[model samples]
Target chain A: MRIERADFPTSVTLDVRAGQPLALVGPNGAGKTTVLHAIAGHLPIMIGSIQLGDRELVELAPEARRIGVVFQDFLLFPHLTVADNVAYGLRMCGSGRKPARAATLPWLERFDLSDLAGRYPHELSGGQAQRVALARALAAEPEALLLDEPMAALDVEIRDEVRAQLADHLRDFAGPTVIVTHSAADVAALAADVVVLERGAVTQRGTWESLRAAPATPYVARLVERREE
Target chain B: MTPARRSGPAVIIWVIAALALALLVLPLLGILLSAPWPHLPALLVAPETLQALGLSLLTGVISTFCCLVLGIPLAVVLARSVGWAVVPRRLLRAAVTVPLVLPPVVGGLALLLLLGRNGILGKYLAQLGITLPFTTGAVVIAQTFVAMPFLVFAVEGALRGADRRVELAAASLGATPFQVFRTITVPLVAPGIAAGAVLCFARALGEFGATITFAGSYPGVTRTLPIASYLASQTDLNQSIALALVLLVVSVAVLLGLRDRWLPGVRG
Candidate 1:
């Protein structure tokens, strides 16, 4: 997919084969999230086009794009149960009660959240909430997935563990997924290709190995240094 | 509990707070003590009193429903302007709140000029064989007119405080705008909506000046509880006191029910 947002003064162009996860890593205010938002049709892109598999996404409404997003803080509906949160998108698309509830079963099992089906978002720990959020996103069966700061809100001790778990899931997903984060560790663990953004511009794009071997920008060089530390 | 040390300024602050509390409560205390206990039951059972009470309850409920239907959307519109430039939003807010600060009698007069039989749109209504002045429907309109601002402001405050990021997340999850509004927006601010509805209901129940001016006091029609109590004051002092006591008790109950919101740190 190629997405550009001139309104944000940021333009991003990328191509991804299905089942390959790309990471958009940058410093804060580098417009990593802005790029993801433009692709998801949340923020309007004034100049340039966003196309996914011959379908123009820039002009489509968010609901019409068939894209799933897991936010930085999970953004689970606090009033809904774990199962109901997962079931929400299906229900919105006109699924019956039985079908929606049934659809959440596999995702709940996949995320190891079956036992927490009846619990509210507030009752779940941060790690559990993250899993539930991912499950909620996956239940919608979108053409593409976008995750913003996937491991940012997790407890420091469990961050790597969750990252490993998420990496396992991303490997199995057969969609073009983009994860926006500032963490080099997240880029190393969860993604195959890294797109380094700096100051609302594309600084470098390559495999982590290539980017580290010949760091193109000061930001990429710093990221490699931070990753080593 | 041991007393903490208090300085002169702290002691003065405490005394002033207590005095302010008394200023609010003393009038209610007077109402409670001065109610005619001996004849309260009889006064309450009187046919006119029962009719007025039933009418008040009915109109109050219907008006509250109207406020919910109209006010919630307006509140959402107003709240959505939070990210925009301030001046136009403030102007819209002031326009909606005009009825709140405007005298109830004046509001009733304005409504009469717009909807009364001989008035502007009312002339058209008259041609269609309809007359709104001195009607039961006019009572509901007046109460809604005077009370809708309360609901709008309350829900707007709630909407303003809600997390917009969650809404963006929902939209990305393939929820249509209406679906997001129903499932996400409404539930997130459910407490505010409930509070606004309660405030709307109470205000509608107590509405007097606008209802009297627009609908006029016709027995079993526009003469609601407040109007009945007012009429009672001319003939029987005991009945009026009993009705006033009822109103006071209801107001106290509403205040207590909303204590958590107004009186912070008070756990039920």
Candidate 2:
């Protein structure tokens, strides 16, 4: 998959291979969310094209693109039960309720959320909501996955445990995964390759250790050194 | 209740709150106190009174339904027009809310000019063999014209307050825009919509000036409860007071009945 948008303060291109997790690390207002939103087709890309496999993502609607997104706050439908939330994507694709429920069972089991299937989102803890969000996104059978600040909303005490769980899920996912975050620890643990973005531009692109060793810019070097600390 | 030990700010705030509460509730209290209780039941059971009450309910419900059907889309467009040009957005908002600020009689006059027989659109409507003025339908139109802005404002506020990220997430999961609106937007703002509908109904039920101006007060036809009360005041003050008490009681009951359902935690 490739994405390019040439507008100032948001101009950047991303090349991602299938089954690889790429983390775009940047400071606040570094256009990280803008990049994720652009790839998710929420924001229009004016100057460049986004091609996923043989399909051009720029031509498709956000719904038709089949791109699963886990929002920063997890945005679980408060009105829906855990099971229904998981089943929503299937229902949207025209599956009947019975079949949608049937297909959603595996996702509940995979997230260890089988017991909470009937509970509303408000009833869940942060960690539980995060898992439910991931399950909801993956249940849609998307061509790619985009996670925005996956662990940012989690409690600090549970961050490591949930991050490990999310890493495992991303490892199991066969499609390309892109995560935008300010946390270098998130990149180290979850991402295979890191793209250092600053001021809406890619300053460095390589594995975490290579960027840590080479230190392309002061911001990238500071990020790497902070993670080591 | 002691005045001796109160702090300065607390006393000032309490005074302001008490004055505001008095401003709101004193008139209603006066009405309740002034009503002649002994003659109330006989007055309400009168044929003209019953007819007007029934007409009020019917027109109020119809107009509230119309407001819901028409106003929800208007509210959605208004809320989503945040991205639109500032001039047009403000103009639309102002236009929708014009009835809220415009005198009810003037609103009725405008509707008459637009839809009265021999009026611009009314001429065409009359040619089709449909005359609207002084009809029960005209009463409903007048009520809707004045009352819909309350609903549009309420639902628009709710829609703006709703977390739009949920809609985006639904779209990303492959739900169509209409699907997202139905399943997500509507449900998220259901409480606001319900409250708005109730408000619209209450406003429509109480509509007097517009109904009288546009539809006229004909017994068992365009005459609603307010009109009946006005007509009764000319002949029998006690009966008019009774009718006023009925309207007050019904409006209070409607609010009290649905208060907790739509506005949880609000103390009556």
Candidate 3:
């Protein structure tokens, strides 16, 4: 997948290859999530094109883009049970309720969320909700996956465990994955390639170790120091 | 018990509050006290009273249905017009709210000017052999015109308060825009729609001015319960009071029953 936007002063160009997850790390207002939203076809780019394979994604509506987005808050459908939420995409794609439920069983087992199928989002813990969000996103078999601060909503006590589980899920999905985050720990655990975005532009791009060795911006240096700590 | 300890301002505030409460409660007390208790059952079952009650219910239901069919989409459009230019959005809002504040009689007159037999649109409609004024259809139209704003406002508030990100999430999950509206947006605001429908129905049930001006009350055809009460007052004072008591009871019952269940934010 390739994205190029040149309309604004802070133009951004990004490329992600299949089976290789990339982390876009930036401070708040650096437009990390905006990039994710643009890729997912939620926001319009004034002068750019987003291409997934040979298809032009910029001209397509969000649903037709076939991208999975795990929002910062997880955003589990509060009115639906865990099972229905996971099966929503299948149902939307024209699967009957029984068939969708049947298809969702493997995802439930894979995510270890079988026991929570009947429960609603409000009844789940932070970690449980994250797993359900991931399960829901991946169940539709999207061509690309975007996660916005996947571990941001979890408590400090469970962040490590959930992060490990999330890393496993991200690795298992064979697609171009982009994780937008501000945390150095997420970079260390989840992504192999790092793109440091500041003020809506990419400041540095490299492996975590290489970026640590030669930090290009003050934000990158601070991030490297924090990771060392 | 602690009257002596109360400050002067506190005592004055309490007295003023009590007076305000009495101002609202006194009229309801008057209605109940003046009701003819022994003849109340017979008065309620009277043919004219039943006909008026039945007409009121039918028109109220039909008008509320019309409000829902028309008003929900209007509310959704108004709520989602956040990115629109300020002037147009404001104009749209003002148009929706005009009927809410406009005198019901004036609203009826406006409808008449648009749909009456000799009026602009009505003249064309008459050419096609369709006349609206002084008909049961006119009562439904008048009630709908007056009460639709209540539903629009309620549903608009609900739509605005709902998380747009959830809809975005649904979109990213491969649900089309219309699918998201049906499966997510509507369910998220279902309670608000229910409350709005109830308010609209109650407003329609109590509709008098517009119906009288536009539909011109006729026994068993256009005369509703409120109109029946007003007409009965000139002939039999006791029957009028009984009809009013019935209206009061029904309205109070509906509002009270739904308030705690649907509108937790609305409290004394």
Candidate 4:
């Protein structure tokens, strides 16, 4: 995946190789989610292009971008049951209900959500909801995945467990994955590489170990301290 | 902490509130007290009464359906118009609100000028051999014109209040814009739509001015229950009160039943 845009204070350019996950860490209002939204085609890139392999994603509509986005809130459709939510993408792709449900079974089993298939989003725990959001996004079989603050919505006690599960899931998918988060723990657990975004521009790019050894900015230093704590 | 004591202003406020409640309730109380209770069954079963009742219900239902079909889309557009220029958005809102505040008789006159024979669009409709005024269709049109704002405003509020991020989530999941709207947006606002529909139906049922002015009273054709009740007032006061009592009961029953079933957190 490649994103190049010049609308920011400094030109922002990013690349993630296939099967490699990158975490974008930034302070609040640093435009971390904006980067994910641009890649997912939810926002327009005024002066640049987003390319997934050879396909120019910037010109496509969000639905046509073949990019899965797990939003900060999970955004599980409150009206749909767990099974139906998982099956929604397939249904939208013109699969019959029976076939969609059939295709959703593996995802449900993988996420350990089979028992909760009939339950609504309101009934799910935060951890379970996170898994459901991941399963729902992956079920669509998109070419790329963007997760905005995936662990932000979970309880602090469950974040580590959910992050491990999320990392496992990310490994199983072949697409380039980008996670927008503030936590250094998320970077350590889920991403192969870390990109520090500040004020809509990438300030540093390296593996978590390298970033920890030599932090780029005060914000990065604080993130490293928090991780140690 | 000790319970806050009611001040002198609070006592005065409570007294004024009771007076306001009485102002609203006394008329309905008078209707109930003056109704010919013993003769209600006989009066209600009369052919004229039954016809008016049936017409009112049929037109009310039809108009509500019309409002849903038309108003839901309008509400969606209006709610999504937040990105539009301030002047245009305000103009659109003001246009929608006009019928809500304008006198029903004026609305009827507007409809007449627009759709009545020899009127603007009505002249062309007349050329097409489709007269709208003084017909059953006119009653429905008038009712829809007056009652649509209720549904539009309600559904618009719901649409605006709905979490739009969920829609982006759906789009990211490869659901087309239309699919997201149909599967996610509509279900999210279904309760609002239901509440709006009930309000629209009640408004349509109680419609008197527009129906009278645009469609005129023609017994089974346009003389709905409210119009019939008004006509009966000139002849038999007892029968008029009886008809009104029927309207009051039906409206209350519908509001209570649907409100409890669909509108959670709205119960008294």
Candidate 5:
């Protein structure tokens, strides 16, 4: 969908069909997260609009947008057990207890966190917490998914494991997913059309092949150079 | 463990700690020791004492609930910026702390001026047949007014520490702000909220000056434990001591028990 934000040029757009994974790559402080926040309705967008399929999201609140966001830090509720954390969005749906909790099991299994359901966020390893967070976000069954700096909190050791898990999860996701990250490896892993952000503006919008072959802005050039570096 | 190994400074510290402990513990010890040993069972059996105790518990719970209902949202507001402007935020914060720092009696007078039957706002409210002063409702209000800031201040501090990014994550997850508060924000800050509630509950339980001055001392109505204790102090030292002891024991026990659940990092 076309998610145009304030001060952003109207011609510059990134459109995605359902189930298409869009990996947003940019330099630090390049407003990658801000664009994702705009799409998710976390930040105010003044001039332009955001749409998911036929529904205009610019007028809606964040919840009404039904956009699932997995943050960089995972942001799992420290007070809740892993099961309850995964069951969070379901509970928000205002369902009965048995069904709501039962609905969480499939997601926990999808994340392979069935064994760690009783654990708190602080109790899990970074990778485990990340999966739980993903599972938690997905339980809502939103029209779109946004991940800001996914896998950034992981140590160098577990990043691969978490990325593979995330990749598998993203592959089966049925919604338009936007992942905001500065990491080239994660961008490649998701196999998404690249959206390069620079100072709250979209500098380059294309698949990795197009963007890498002929980089548009200095930001994309640095990204491509960093890939070589 | 050895006397000879203890240096002069160490001895001084030990003496000071012991003296401080004695100063704190003596009156409480004396209360129990000097209690009517022969009539202890009878005193416990006294119907008025039991009623006062029960009333204290009920009023404390009710007032604390009232405080929570009105205070938590106020705390969240105080903690977070509503708009970019700083002046309004400062005003709101100062307003919350006004009831906190004001002498409880003066606070009672202020509430009277605003809420008493003859007072400006109170007169308008009276036309609607609502009189707050010297009523059970007034008791709850006065206690809530004096005690609410404890909860508000505490929960605000908790809210300040709340990771906005986590809230953003929840918002991104399609949680409305209310849902975010219910599921994420409140649960994330549950311990702080709990601590605040407990502090408010204890303060409400022991609320004396404002409650008495505003609500008046009416038996089984406006007369809470502290008021009961105060009135009893005029005629019956034993009953006063008993009530005071109950408040003392309950406050300490509740605070200590709640510490584990709400204040996790507190060391002995």
Candidate 6:
């Protein structure tokens, strides 16, 4: 599917395929998140059409667009238990309290949160909260998932483990996925189809391996190299 | 245990703390110690005392209900506005804080001016066959006007400090704005709201100036415990002291009940 924003005061266009994970990588302030937000229906698109699985999604509200978002901060509800957090969408969708709660069990089991389902979000570790956040998004069964900097909030040592876990989760998820990241390690860890964004426009789009072959900018080169100084 | 030793600046700090604590506790101590030695238990069973206590509870609960319904939305509007959002929000914020700064007597006068039968807008309300001033309804209005600011301040502080990114996440999950507020925002800020409600309820329970001025002291109608105490002081000093002792007991009970909920590491 193609997404374009003509009146963003900037010409922006993005192309994503079904069952593909597109990673947006760029320097700080490059508008990578902006594009992701536009697709997720958080940002207003002056002139654009967003399609998800042959359906126009631009007209939908952020919640109604059938897209899951995992924020950088995890954004788990502090007052809610892990099970309730996962069940939030189901509950909101008018599922009764009993069934809504019961529906989250399998998701909790998949995330290894079954034992800790009763614990509040504040009681979970950072990695654990992030996983719960992912499970929460997936429990709703959205048409697409938008993950923004999944590993950024993680500490150095836990990064690899979380990244691996997130990769595995994304692999089994049956929807187009778009991940925004500032770190090249995240790009590699996700092994996403590269969509290099620069100041609200897509500079390049291709497979990660192909982008590594010929990076247009030094920023892109560093993205493939995973270097920070 | 021996009192902690202090020297110089530390001594001064301790003295200040002690003085502040004493200022708070002395009145309570005095009320307890100065109560009439005879017929105190009889006063508890008195019908007039029960009526005032019941009226106070009723008015306090009603006023607090009004505060919650009104204050939370105002807090949200004030907290979320930008530069253009500033002017109107500032005016509203200033207006809410007015009842807090203005003496309750002046607040009562203001309410009388706006809501009394001869008051502005009262003429139109009268045409609608509704008269507000000097009724039990007026007592609730007066108490709510004075108490809602406390709820607004508490809820506003909590809303400002809340991580709104969670709201954005909620939005992305297909929740309507209202749904997100009900399901997520309300639950997270519930502690602050609870604190604000406690403050409003306590203030309303003791409200006198606005209630007496606007609603007028009518036994079993507008007469709450505070107003009852004030009126009782006019003729019987010991009876007023008895009333004061009763107020102190009620406050202590409320504090004890709510303390664990508000305080960390304390079980409710």
**DockQ (0 to 1) for model 1:** 0.60
Models 1 onward score TM values of 0.94, 0.94, 0.94, 0.96, 0.86, 0.90
Winning candidate number (DockQ): 4
lDDT of 6 by residue, B1-268 (tens): 3346535668898999999999999988887788886978877767878899999899889999999998888777767764456678678779878999899999999899998888898878999999998889999999999999889888888888778778888888889999988987877677778888888888888798988999998999988899888888998877788777787788777656654375321112
lDDT of 4 by residue, A200-223 (tens): 788889999999899989988999
Docking class of 5: acceptable
Per-residue lDDT of B143-188 in model 4, one digit per residue for the tens? 9999999999989988888898899999988899999989999888
The residue-level lDDT of candidate 1 at B149 comes to 93
> What lDDT would candidate 3 get against the real structure?
0.91
Docking quality category of candidate 3 according to DockQ thresholds: medium
For model 3, residues B1-268, the per-residue Cα lDDT tens digits are 5767668778899999999999999999999988899999999999988898899989999999999999999999999888899999999999999998999999988899999999979999999999999999999999999999999999999999988789999999999999998899888887789899999999999999889999998998899999999999999999899889888988887677655465322111
**Model 1: residues with Cα > 4 Å off, grouped in runs:** A6-8, B1-6, B84-87, B259-268
Best by TM-score: 4
Error of 3 at A183 (Å): 1.0
The lDDT values for all models are: 0.87, 0.91, 0.91, 0.91, 0.81, 0.84
Give me the runs in candidate 4 sitting further than 4 Å from their true place. B1-5, B258-260, B263-268
Predicted candidate 5 versus true structure: per-residue lDDT over B126-234, tens digit per residue: 9999999998888888888889999998888888887867777666665678988877777667778898889998888888888888889888887877888788889
TM-score of 6: 0.90
Candidate 2 lDDT, A1-229, residue by residue in tens: 8888787778888888877899999889999999899889898887888889888988788999999999889999988999999999999999999999999999999999999998889889999999999999999999999999999999999999999999999999998899999898899999998898888889899999899889989889889898889
- Report the lDDT of model 5 for residue A33: 72
